[model samples]
Target: MVSHDPAPADPLSLHGVVPPTVTAFHDDESLDEETTAAHARFVVDRGVHGVFPLGTNGEFPLLSDDERDRVVEAVVDEVGGEVPVIAGVGAPSTHRTIARAEHAASVGADGIVVVTPYYYPLDGRAALDHYRAVADAVSLPLYIYHIPSKTGNELSLSTLSELAAIDAVAGVKDSSKNVPWLAQAIDGHPELTFLAGSDSLVFTGLEIGCSGAVSAVANAFPELVVDCYEAYADGDEERARELQSTMFEVRDAFKAGGAYMSGVKTALRLREFDAGPLRSPLRLKDEEATAELRDRLESIDDLEW
Candidate 1:
C-alpha cells in the first residue's frame, strides 16, 4: 500500500461541522475570489472545524478548471492553518479528477473529496480502479464524495470495503441519504472516517458514529450546526436535538420554495455577507419568492438570520 505523512493533524481525525461553502460570484456571474475567501473566513470564525470548497454546494460542475483552482487557492490562502481545507476535486473522468486533485494539493489543500465519476454508469471494479489511480497520484487524504442522487453512481459496501484498504483513502462524505448504507459503511470500516453530507442527518449521523458532517446549511448558518455538534460531543443529546430542531426549521425555511441552493446564498445575504449570485443555469429566487423566504426565515425566533 502507498502511504504518505499526514498533513497537519491527521485528516482522518477531521471532525465537527465542516461547511461545503458556496462559490461566491459577482453580479456579472464572474468568480468572486475575494468574497469566496471571505466566506471561508466567516465560517471558520463561527467555529466550524473545517471548510470544504468546490463541492456540490460550491457549484463545482459550473466552474472552469481555472476558476476551481483559484477558489481552492483563495480559500487556503485565507484560512489554511486555522482549519483543514478539504477541497472538492471531483470531475466526471478519472484523468480530469486526478488533475484537479493534483492542483488542490499543489495549492495547499489539506485533503481532497473525489465524488464518484458521474454521467456514466460504472460497476464496482471500475469505481475501485478510479479511486486507486487518484489515491496513487496524491499524497493527501482522499475522501469519497457519495451523493448518488446527483451523481447517479452509488457505491456498494463491497467496493467501500476494498477502498478502506488503500492507505491514501482516508474517509467518506456520504450524501447518499441512505441511513442503513451509511450505518453499514461505518460498521464495515471503522478505519475510514465517515461524515454525514446532508444537513438533515447531522445529529442522526453522530448518533450512529459518524465523526462529523459536511453541511450545506452551515454555509449560511454554521453556528447552529456547530452548536448541535458541540452539544452532541459534550454528551447533551437533548440539547443537540433541540438545536437540530432549530436547524431543521432553518433548513425548511431555506427549502421553502424549492430553491434551497439559492436560499443558502440568500440567507447569507440577509445576514449582510453578500456571497453574490450563483453561476449561470442556476439562479436566485424571484423577488416575491425571495421576500417570502426572508419573512419565513425571520419568523424563526431562535435564529438571527
Candidate 2:
C-alpha cells in the first residue's frame, strides 16, 4: 500500500478546483486541437488550480489511444508549465491503462487519473491488485478515480486503505455521491487526499476534509467553482454555502437538460467554445432544452470569470 507523502515541494500537489476539460471536435468529428488548446488555456487562465484532460467529461472512452496521446500532448504543450496538467489514463484493461499512464508521464503530465476497471466488475481483492499494479507501473503520482455509476465498481474503504499504503497512490477522486462513504474514506486515512469528483458536492466534500474537486462544470464556469473552494478555505462558511447553493442550481439545470456531460457541452457551445456534441448514444439535448440551459446559465450574473 502506498502512503501519502506530504505535499510535494514541486508544483503538482493539486489543491483547489481542477476542471476536467471537454474534448472539442470539428464538424467532421475529428479532434480539434486548436479549440482544445484554447479551452485548456482558458480554464487555467481563469484561475483554476490545474487542468485535467481525457476524463469522463472529456469523453475519453470514445477516443482512441493515439488520439488520447495527441490530446494530452497538446494540453501539456499549451499549458507549458503555467499550470499543472493531470492526464486521465483510464483504459478498460490494466495493461493498456498502465501504458497510458506511462504515456502521460512521457508527455510531461504532472499526474494521472485512473478509473477502476470497467468491463469486469472485479471483486475487492482484484480491484486492490489492479490499482497496485498500475501504481507500481508508473513513477508519476496517481489519483484513483471512483465513479462507480459509470464503471460499475466501487472502491471500498479497505481497498482505499490498502491503496493508501502504496507510495505512488497519492489520492482519490471520490465520485460516489455517498457522503457517509466519503466521510469514512477521509476519516480512515488521514494521509491520503480525497478530491470530490462530482461538482454538486464540492463544498460539502471540502467541509469534510477533501483536498479539492475535479469538476466537469468548471469547464464552463471555472470562476464559480473556484470561488466556492476559496470561500470555504477562507473560513467564510456562509459565502461558501451560498456559492455551493448556486453551483447546485447550475447542476440542477444541467440535469434538467440531460446528464451533466451533455449539458456541459451545451453550455460551452453557448459560450462560443465550439466544444462539439457528445459522441453517439450520448445524444445532445433538443433545441428547446438547449435554449433553456442557456437561459439558466446566463441568468446567473456572476458565472463569468
Candidate 3:
C-alpha cells in the first residue's frame, strides 16, 4: 500500500475533507458567480481541505458548457491557492469530457474528476479508451468518478486496474456504496488515491484506506466531516466512530422527506449561507418536510446548525 506521506508534486495525494461544492443560482435560475465563489470561500474558511465544483452535488449535468467553465473559473479564482480545486469534467462522451477537462486545466484547476460516460452501455475497452483519450487531452491529474448508481455504468475490477495503470489517471471517487468492491479496488491499486464519493461512506471508506472523501454533506457541514476525518487521522478511532455516527445522523436528517439532492442547499440557506435553489426537476422539500428536517437538525446537540 502507498504510504500516507504527503507527495508535494502529486495532485492525487490530496486528502481530508474535500467538499463537492454546490453551484449557486439566482431565483431566476441564472448562474450566480458571486454566491458560488462565496460558498467556496466559506468551505475553505471552515477548514475544508479542498473544493470540487461541477460534480453531482454541483448540478453539473444541468449546466451548459459555458456555465460549467464559469463555475470552475469562479471556484478556482476564489480558492485555487487556499486548496486544491479538483473540478469535475466528465460528460457522456469522450471528446466532450476532454473539452471540459481542458477548460478546467486552463482555469487553474489542480486536477480533474471524470465521471464515467453515462446513458450508453460501455464495455471495458470503450471505457478504457474513453478515459485514455481524456487523460491524454490534458496535463492535469485525472480522477475517475465511480457512481454507477446514477451513471448506470459500473467499472469492473479488471477495468479499474487497467485505468490505474494510466500515468495521468491518478485516483478514484467511489460513490458505488459497495464496501466490498471499494475494498478490493483499494487493495488492488494502492498507487491510486481513493476517495469516498458518498457522505454515507466517508468513515467506512477511510477505514478501508481511502485517503479522504468527496462528501455531498460537506457542502453544507464541512466542519462536521472535517472533524470526523481529523479524528481518524489523529489516531483517535473511538472519536472518529462517534463522529461517524453523528455524520450518519445528519445524513438521515437531511434525507428526511426525500431531501437527498436539495438538502445541502436548504441547510446552507438555513445557516444563512446562500446556496440558492436547485435547478429544474429537483425542488426543495415541501414546508412540512422542511420543518421536519429543521426539527431533526436542531435536535442534534453537537451540530450548531
Candidate 4:
C-alpha cells in the first residue's frame, strides 16, 4: 500500500477540499487572468486543500491549448506554495495530453490530473497504455481523473489497478460518484489515493476511506467544504454528517438548474465574486432555477460565506 502521505513535497494530498475552479472569462468570452487568479486566492484564503483549473468546471474543452496553459500559469502564480496546484492536463489524444502535462510542469503546477480521453471509447488495454504513456511522459505526480459521465471511456478495475502500479501515478480522482465502486478502488489498490470527485459524495467518500473531494460546489462554498473535511478528520461524525447534508443541499440546488457548470458559476457570482459566465454551447439562462438555487442556499443558515 502506498503511504497516506502520497508525496513529501505536496501537503495537499487526498484529504481535503480541492475545487475544480470555474474559469473566469471576459464579457466578450476571452480569458480573464486577473479574475482567475483572484478567485484562486479567494478559495485558498478559505483554506481549500488545493486548486484545480481546466477540469469540467473550468470549461476545459472550450479552451484552446494556449488558453489552458495561460490559465494554469495564472492559477499557479496565485496559489504559490500554499497548496499543491493540480492542473487538469487531459486531452483527446495522448500526444496532446502529454503536451499539456509538459506545459503544466513548465508553469510550476505541483501535480497533473489527467481525465480519460473523451469522445472515443477505449478498451482496457488502450486505457492502460494511455495512462502508462502519460505517467512515463512526465515526472510530476499524475492523478487519474475518472469522470466517465463526461468522458466516454471508463477505466475497468483491472486496468486501474495496473495503472496504479506505475510509480508516477499518484492518485485517482473518482468523479463517477459510485460509492461502492469507489470503495472497491480504495480497498483494492492501497497504492493509489482516491479523491471523491463529486460534491455530494465528499463526506461519504471520506467515510469510506477516500482521501478527499475535488468538488464543483466547492467553488462557491469553500469554507463549508473545508469545515466538513476538518470535522471528519477531527472525528466529529455528527458535525461532519450535518455539514455533509448541507453540502448535498447545495449540490441539489445547483443540479436543479439544467446547465450544471453554469449553475456553479452563477452561484459564485451570487456570492459577489467575478466568476464570469459560461462559454458557447453551455448557457445559464434559467431564471426560475437560478432563483430556486438562491432560495435553497439562503435557507442553509450555517452555510454562510
TM-score (all chains, Cα) for each model:
0.96, 0.94, 0.96, 0.94
lDDT of 2 by residue, 1-305 (tens): 12222244323677889899878887678888778888998888888988889988888999989889988998999995887788999877889999999999998998988998897878888888888898898898888889899899988788788888878887888888999999888878777777888987888888777878899889988889989888887778888888888888788778775776788888777877777767777766789999899788777765662
> How well is each residue in 1-305 modelled by candidate 4, as lDDT tens digits?
12223333223454588899878989888999889889899889998988999888889999999999999999999996888899999998999999999999988998899999989988888888888898888889989999899897888888888887888888889989777788888888766777889888877888777777898878888999899888888878889889889887887778776766777887887888966778887776478887888887899877895
Residues 1-305, candidate 3: write the lDDT tens digits: 22333224356578988898899999889999999999999999998999889989899999999999999999999999888999999999988899999999888999999999999999999999999999889999988999999999999999999998898988888999999999999888777888888887877888888889998888888888899888888888788788888888888988988758778888887789977789987887778887988898898866855
lDDT of each: 0.88, 0.83, 0.87, 0.84
lDDT of 4: 0.84
lDDT head-to-head 1 vs 3, winner? 1
How far residue 93's Cα lies from its native spot in candidate 2, in Å, is: 1.0
